[model samples]
Target: MEWAALLLLALALCALLYLLGRWLLGLDGDLTLLWAEWRGKRPENELPDKVVWVTGASSGIGEELAYQLAKIGALVVLSARRENELERVKQKCLEISNLSSKDILVLPLDLTDRSSHEAATKTVLQHFGRIDVLVNNGGRSQRSLFVDTKVEVYAAIMELNYLGTVSLTKHVLNHMVQREKGKIVTMSSVMGIMGAPLATGYCASKHALQGFFNSLRPELGEYPEIIITTICPGPVQSKIIHNVFTEDLSKSLDNTGDQSHKMPTDRCVRLTLVSMVNDLKEAWISDHPYLAVCYLWQYAPTWAWWLMNKMGKIRIQNFKSGVDADISYSQKKKA
Candidate 1:
C-alpha cells in the first residue's frame, strides 16, 4: 500500500509538471511559428510613411487601431458608414497629436458597397500616392435565432463581412503586388473558430475570413515582402454588442448587449498592432490562452470543445436562431 501511494504521488507530480510546461512555459509544438515571425527585423518601416487604410474606424477596435497607428506616424485612412462618427474619431485622433493630423484621413464608407471600396482606394492613392497596408476589421454580429432568421439578414451579414473584405483586398492587391510589398491584416473572432449559439451568420462570415486569408497568405508569400496576418480574439469589452443584428433585422440593437465586462479595448487593439507590426501569421486573444489550447487539442477525435462550451455561459443556450426570434426584431419594428 505504501509503495502504491508513492507511485500515485509521483505520477501526479509528473502530470502537473507536464501541464505547467505546456501552459505557462508555452513549450508546445510549432516553435517554428515564432521563428517565422519577422519580429525585431522590421523592413525600415514602409508602414508609417505609406498609406494604411482601416475599415470600421468609427468606434471600438477600429477606432482604437486608427489612433494607435496614427501615433506611430502611419498615414492612416479611416472608413465606416457613420460619417459623423468617423469625423469625431478623426478629430479626436488629430487632437491627440500633430503627427496624426497630417497622417490621419477620414473617408466614410459602407463596406457592403463594392464601388465604395474601389473609390476609397482611389481616394487613398490620390491623397497619399501609395497604399502599404490594409486592415479589414469592419464587421457586425448577429444575435438572432437561426430558425427565425430572414434570408436578407444572412445575405447582408455575408455581403458586408466576407464579400466586402475580399472585394477591398482584391481591388488593392494589384498595386501591392506591383509594389512587391504590403501587409494585410484580417480580424476574425474566437467565435470564428468556435461556433456560438445565435450567431450562425456571424460565425460563417468569420470562418470564411480564416479560410480566405489562410489561402491568400501563401500566394502573397510569392512576393516574399507582402505579409498576411489573421487575428482571432474572444469577446472584448467594446460597443460591438450594441451594433449586433437581432431577429427583427434591426440596426438598433440593445437586447443582446454583451455586458460581461471583459478585456479593455485599448489593450486589445494594442496587441493587434504589435502582432501586425511583428508580421505574425496568427494571434488569439482572450482572458486566458484557451484559444491556443483549443488549437492544440483541435485534432482530438471527440469534439471536447463542443462539450466544454455547452457547459459554459459562453455557449449561450437561450439564444434564438433566426432574426425573428431575437427580441430586437419586434423592438425595431415598434420604433
Candidate 2:
C-alpha cells in the first residue's frame, strides 16, 4: 500500500512537470509579455481614448496594429511615405471601429526625411492636443551577404532603420518629456537579440535600436510615467520580405518565401499592446525555436553561438537557393 502511494505521487509529479514544460514550449512570447497578456493590464482597459501615432502604418505590422487599436477604441494617427495607402488603412479602421473620420488621422511621413519629423510631431499634437503614445514602427530589413552587399546599402539601412527612428523619437520624446507621461513603443525584432546570416545589416540596425532604447530608459529616470518599451517580435506574417534591402539599394527580393508558418500579425500586435499597457521595459514576442533561442542568447551565449552556427548555415543555403530561409528548414522538419 505504501509503495503504491509513493509510486502514484511520483507519477503525478512527473506528469505535472511534463505539462509545465509543454506549456512553456507552446508559448509564442516571452514569459513576462505573456504574463501581461494573461493577467496584467488589458489594452482595452488602458489604450481607449489614448492617442497613438504609428509609423509604417501603410502595411504589414503597422497596418494590422491600426486595425486592432481601432477595435480597442484608441484614437490613432497613421503615417507612412504613401498617402494613398494610409488613407486605405484609415478607411478600414473607420469601417471596423466606432471611431469617426476625425478620430483617425492619415499623415504621410517619410522616416528618412529627418527635416520633416519636427513638423510632423507638431501636426500630430495640433490635431490631437497631445501625443499619448508613439509607435516607432518604421524601418526596413536586409537580406544579403555582407561581402556581396555594397557599403551604400549598409548606410541606407542605418539611415532608415536606426537614424530615422532616432530622429522621430527625438522629436516625440521632447513632447513626452514635457507631458511627463506616455508610452514610446518601438517595434524591434528577435534579430535584435541574436545574429544570423543573410541579415548582417538588419541585425546591426536592430542591435542599435536595442542599445538605444535600453540606454534611453535609464536617462528618463526623472519621468517615471514616461514608459520606454521595446518590442522584439519574431517572424510574424507580413510583407517585410518584399521590402528587404538586398545586395544593392536598387534591387529587391525576387522570392519572398512562404510566410504562412510565421506567427500571426494580430497575435503579435495584441501582445505589443499588452506590453505597452503593462509598462514592460522590454518584451520578446515570438514563437518557438526563435523564442527559445532568445533565452539561450541571453543566458548561455556560448551555447547560443553554437546553435546559431548550425542554423546560420541552413539560412545561407536557403537564401542562395532562392527559397524562404526561415521556411525551408522548418518545412524539412515537417516532412
Candidate 3:
C-alpha cells in the first residue's frame, strides 16, 4: 500500500513539473516540433523530376520556390499574369539548374479570371502529362479599415484570393483525384488564423481558405497519397506590402514598416518547402515571434483579443499619419 501511494505521488509530481516547464521554460514549441519530427509526418519522397505548378511565380515566395524546386530537378510550371516576368523567372531557373527552357513552362495566369482555369489546366497536362503538386501562392493584401473600405474591395479580394484560388484548385484537383496521388499547397497568412487591423477583407479571405481546406482534408482521407498543406507566414520581406489594397481597391505603392526585421523571402520559401516535404497539414513559417501570437490566439483567446486591439490602434494611427498608407499593387514588372 505504501509503494502504491509513493508511485502515485511521483506521477503527480512529474505532471506538475512538466506543466511548469511548458509555461515557465517555454518548451512547448520545441516539444511540439520534436514530436512532429519523431512521428516522421513529413513527406519523404524526393522531388527530382516531379512536375510542380506554382502560381504567383513572377515574384516573392512563389518565384523563390520555383528556383529552389528547379535546382532540385523539379519540372516547374511558372504562372502569373505577366508572361514576360514569368519568362524571366524561367530563364533564371534555367541558369541555376540543369533544366532546359522546355522543362520550365511559362504559363501566364490571372487568378481573377475564372474562365481561363480550364484551359490553363489543359495546357499544363498537355505539357507535363500530370501535376504532382499545385502551389497556390497568389493573392492580394488589404490595408484599410473595414468601415472605410468599399464593398467592391471586399468582393475583389474574395474573388482573387479565395474564389480564384478555389477555381484553379478545382480544375487541378480533378486530375489529382483521378491520379490518386498529389499535393495541394497554399500560402495563407497569419491573418488567416487571427484577425488584424486594416485587414478585414484580407483576413476574411484567408479565414475562408482555412475553412475550405480543413473541411476538404477529411473528404480526401480515402486517398492517403494526396496531401494538403497550408502555410501561414508572418511578415516576410516581400513585395506584398507594396501591393496592398486601399479603401477604393487601389494599390498602395508607399512602403511602410521595418522590413529589415522581417524574414527574408528566400528563408521563408525554404521553411515552407521544409514544411511541405514534411507533409505538414498546416504550418507557420515566420522568423519573428509571430508563432507566439498564434499560440496565444489559440489558447488564450481573451489575451489575443486585447493584444490585437492594441496593435490595431497603433496601425490606425500610422495610417492616419500617411506613414505606411501607400501599400498598393501595380502591373507585374519583369524580374
Candidate 4:
C-alpha cells in the first residue's frame, strides 16, 4: 500500500511539472500581470471619467493608448511633437468613441524640449482640473553597434529617453502629490531589464528609468496613493523600427524589415491598462523566449548571460544584414 501511494505521488508530481511547462510556453506576460488581467480591476471600470495624459500620443503605442482610453471614457490629453498628427489621432478617437471634441485635448508636446514641460503640465491642469494618470511613452530606439555609433547619439538618446521622461514626471508628480493620488506609467522596454548587443544607448536609458522609478516608488511611500508603474514590453507591432537612431545622429535605419512577428499593439495596450489600474510596480509584457529570458535574468544570471550572448550574436548579425535585429532566430537562419 505504501509503495503504491509513493508511485501515485510521483506520477502526480510529473503531471504537474508537465502542465506547468506547457503553461509557461504559452505565457506572453509575467505571472503577476497575467494574474491582474485575470482577477484584478478592469481598466474600463477604473479609468472612466479619469484624466489620462499620454505623451507620444501621435503614433505607435501612444496612439493606440489614446484609442483604448477614449473607448473606456477617460478624458484624453493627446501630446506629441506634431500638432497635425495629434489632431489626426484626436479625430480618429472622436470618430470611434463616444468622446466629444472637448473630451479629447490635442496638446502638441516635444518631450525633448525640457523647458516646455512645465508649461505643458500647467496646461493639462488648467484644462482638466486634475491629472489622474500620466503615460510617458515618447522615446526613440537605437539600431547601430556601439563602436560605430557616435557619442552624440548616446547623449541625445539619454537627453530624450531618460531626462525628458524624468522632467515631465517631476511636474506631473507634483500635481499627484498635491492630490495624494495618481498613476505614473512609463513605457520602458525589455532592454531595460536585460542588455542586448546593438542597443547600448537605448538600454542605458531604459535602465536609468527602471532604477529611477524603482527608487522613486520607495520615496513616495508617504503618498501611498500615488502609484509608479514601469511597463517593459519586449516587442510590439509598431512603426518604431522606422524611427530608430543609427550609427550617426544624421543617419537612419536603412531596412526596417518585417515587424509582423511582434505582439499586437492593442493587446499590449490592453495588458498595460490592466497593469495600470492594478497599480503594479513593474510588468513585463512580452512573448517568449524574451519572456523566458526575463525569468532567467532574475533567477539565473549565469545561464541568462550565456543565452543572451548566443542570441546577441544573431541580433547583431541580423542588423548587419539589413533586417530587423530582433527577427526570429529560426526564421532568419532558415531564410
For model 2, how does the per-residue alpha-carbon lDDT over 80-160 read when each residue is reduced to its tens digit? 999999999999999999999999999999999999999999999999999999999998988999999999998999999
**1 or 4, greater by TM-score:** 4
Write model 1 residue lDDT over 225-304, tens digit each, in one string.
89898877766766787788766665555454334445577767766776677788887765443444446345651565
Per-candidate total of colliding backbone pairs: 11, 0, 9, 0
Question: What is the TM-score of candidate 1?
Answer: 0.81
User: What TM-score does candidate 3 get on C-alpha atoms?
Assistant: 0.84
lDDT of each: 0.72, 0.92, 0.81, 0.92
Clashing pairs for predicted structure model 3, backbone only: 42-278, 43-277, 43-278, 243-328, 251-328, 252-326, 252-327, 252-328, 254-326
Q: What residue pairs clash in candidate 4, if any at all?
A: none
Q: Which 10-residue span in candidate 4 carries the lowest summed lDDT?
A: 326-335
Q: Indicate the worst ten consecutive residues by lDDT in candidate 3.
A: 326-335
Of 2 and 3, the candidate ahead on lDDT is 2
TM-score of each: 0.81, 0.96, 0.84, 0.95
